[model samples]
Target: MSRFHLGLIINPLAGLGGPAGFKGSDGVAQQALALGIEPKAAARTRTALECLLPIKQGLHFLTFPGPMGADLLAEMGFAHQVLGQVHEGPSSAADTREAVEALQQAGVALILFAGGDGTARDICSAVREGQPVLGIPAGVKIQSGVYAINPRAAGELTRRLIEGGLVRLASGEVRDIDEAALREGKVTARWYGELTVPEEGGYLQQVKQGGVESEELVLADLAAWLESNWESDVRYVFGPGSTLHGLAENLGLQTTLLGVDVIENGEVIAHDVSEAQLFELVDGHPARLLVTAIGGQGHIIGRGNQQISPRVLRAIGLGNLRVVATKRKLATLEGRPLLVDSGDVQLDDAFPDVVRVWAGYKEELLYPVGK
Candidate 1:
């Protein structure tokens, strides 16, 4: 049997800017590094690659040299062929594009890359139309639809493809936001292009839905319900999204629109906190995590809320999680279960199969949850 050829690429600085309040990592990796922000692209890529370990003997890996790809593969003991070289410093967008082009020329079965929208844009610019590619969600500005629901999902889907499972090919939109505008509290998302990706609705994330929730009354009701149910001394961690932002406004709490915030005793205590800070705040305290599904993606965790790390989730406990979304948003999922990719497989698996979603005032719907 012929071994399947797999191409791997990792953008080393892909997510450095997210927790550092730089909005995106396109050109601010150095600044983020200077501010002590650690990059997580390699760690996230490792999670995706772990699923393929069982079939390593039947696969041939091709990747760029050094931090871009080969370093992690070597550390994990995956035998792979290095295709290109990295210069003296951090890999740039050109390196990513060059890696994609080289991988295409090598005629690999699929190219698996780890990065945010900027990296997706690089791949889109270099890959030929209809070529198969998949993304591991390792970046901060994950506005594009190319990424899997999480790192593990990416590995699982790749494994399925190598194992001859029924995986269809579909076009995923490549969208990006203006980081400068995003820093100024403005989200300017534009559709750059699309890439062909492995399609398994349960494994892949949909294009992030833009615009405000059309039903104003539903948000008002959600806010009222949350306010009425506020528990004294219980810290409430608010994940990012339009729904949560609107709810914060309704409750007259000043919360960051696209960053994690904490509420205690009906007052905002921490705004735009990182994973370390969140774990510190919620560690020995009773906390409830309030998160809403991404409008069209059906993801309640690990899409854009990486700040709510696994340890933080463990500290808060899974049972204390409160999911809020309009019925219309849930309808967009077309009956697919709400997904969670907390980066910790055990914790992701620990969530109950069924969850209660707060849709309106005193109204809750039993929804299915998936990993």
Candidate 2:
């Protein structure tokens, strides 16, 4: 197989600028030191880089000169040629743009970056269209398809792609949530577009989950069908997303915008249910877990909604799990397969082969997961 020149960049501050409540890591270095938290972002970055060490030399790699990308690469014991240099107190969007330019000049076959939507946007401008790229989840809010499900997944995908294995290729959604509104208990996501990526199959990036993250319902007919078929005996474990809430909204019941809630029949049985409570509710009554994709992250679980772990998914059964999203939302999933990271690797591997997404009417789309 021909060796590919892989570019690496890290917008260390993209998601750090998010709300204080979200634990944005831009100031985490300071916070950790103050609280004597021992390790900091540097430690976490090293941990993430360790995942990539196994296959670093197998593929030709290019990166910024210093902390922009190389510093961490160096900490990982990467002894190789460096591309550009920009070591300062912190990394920013300007540095991201410069690094992209440098990598573009170097003619990298792919640019695997680590950041959120802002970083994705910078890379988008660099590509102008599509470039073979991937993301290592590092930022606070990762609402972009560029990121792999997690750091370890990023390294594994790199290994598979570098080996020239037959892999699935598709465009992933580049969705970003406005950080400001998220602090106000409102989730406002804007669909940027799509990106071509190598699908390492089982790896799932965080995506805007559920049938609805958007407030407006374009799928009125499908919503009506779900409403008509609504079962009273069933407890609906509504995952985080605006789309699932639409099912509740259609019935004139209030749904929590950012938290998970439980619904039975046509009434809101539980609101803002905790993970333990969720398990209890599921145990007592049969429940169907419904969720949407992260706008950019493409994650089905273990991102913000840690409530639905392998135990939860198992209790509900994969057959009973309902993933709902609009055609536009599904369009965001074009290049990437439906991702399921249930925290437990064994169970995550046993995830449903095909996710039944309610695209429209009786018309549904079957998305292959771990394909």
Candidate 3:
């Protein structure tokens, strides 16, 4: 197989991960170390480097400046060239924007970066088309298509992709949350654009979305499917969305419509739990996450339900998660892998072979979500 040329961007402040109560990882860099949060961008970068470590010499890397991209690669002992201006370290999100331009100018096969919703937004703004890309979880709230589940999985997939393994990259919509509104328990997601998603072995992680659905029948079907599937040992964590609220209505439980709800064996255990709380609940039981796409724009995680934190996803097992969507809603996916933008690097990496979305009774569409 021929060597692959990849472009890397590191958004230092993109998601920070502070809002989820998991501590921030990319806040100005300096404060992160002091607080022991560890720079998330660096961690994400390291994940990529470590995965590429054994094959470093065979790979060509183009990256942003220190603290932005290059330095992390250097620290990981990889040989790579710096792209554009070496600004010591990217001081702000603007640096990421600048890196996007440089990567496009250099002409790369794929553009890889790490960050959450804000970082995805920055990436979307930088490049609208050209260059397939993926992400390594590094931000606070990841909600985009440019990222992989985790760093190691990214490396594994990179190997397969470069080695001529049957692989394809698809476009997934870019979704973001209203940060100000988020603080007030209001969740909002808007379409930023689309990015390339790599598909390996017909597996794709669940993608989160945000939009308005006027039809009531689709909601009704989604609710019916969820109700039929509830069983013992299946702890359901309902994410915020009208579709999810519909499920809650079927169960005769009050749902916040925009908050995380926990359903265990037909009982409402908790309502609107936080990331920590969600994980705590997950610790004791087997979980099967139930969430819906944002609508128009498709996303499964990292949009509004920050409460279902990365830790929670990890505890629940990515394979155990269920993305419930009506046929009308699934139509919006357009044969793309569902997006899972969880900010935790490990959880992002832990996603399963085929994310079994509740398509219909005994009928599942095997989508390619990851490499």
Q: 272-357, model 1: which lDDT tens digit per residue?
A: 99999999999999999999999778889899999999999999988789788776677677666678998998888777544557
Lowest lDDT block of 10, candidate 1: 201-210
lDDT of each: 0.84, 0.65, 0.66
Candidate 2 regions exceeding 4 Å error are 1-4, 14-52, 87-89, 202-371
Q: Write down the TM-score of every candidate.
A: 0.55, 0.47, 0.50
Model 3 alpha-carbon miss at residue 168, Å: 1.0
* Number of backbone collisions per candidate: 0, 32, 23
What digit string (tens of lDDT, one per residue) describes model 2 on residues 1-371? 22345677866554444343454444344443454433233444455557667766644567876656677766676654586667466565667778878776665656778776766766776664545667777667777777788777777766555443224455778877765676677888898777766665432232234433343554466667877888879998888777776766766779898889988887788899888888888975678888877754456777768888677777888768766766566556544555767778888756643455664555444454541
Scored by lDDT, model 2 comes in at: 0.65
**On a 0 to 100 scale, what is the lDDT of residue 30 in model 2?**
49
Choose 2 or 3, whichever is better by lDDT.
3
For model 3, how does the per-residue alpha-carbon lDDT over 123-212 read when each residue is reduced to its tens digit? 778884634667777666656666677777877776555443334545767887776666567777788888766656432232223344
Model 3 / residue 17 / CA error / Å: 4.0
On a 0 to 100 scale, what is the lDDT of residue 333 in model 3?
57
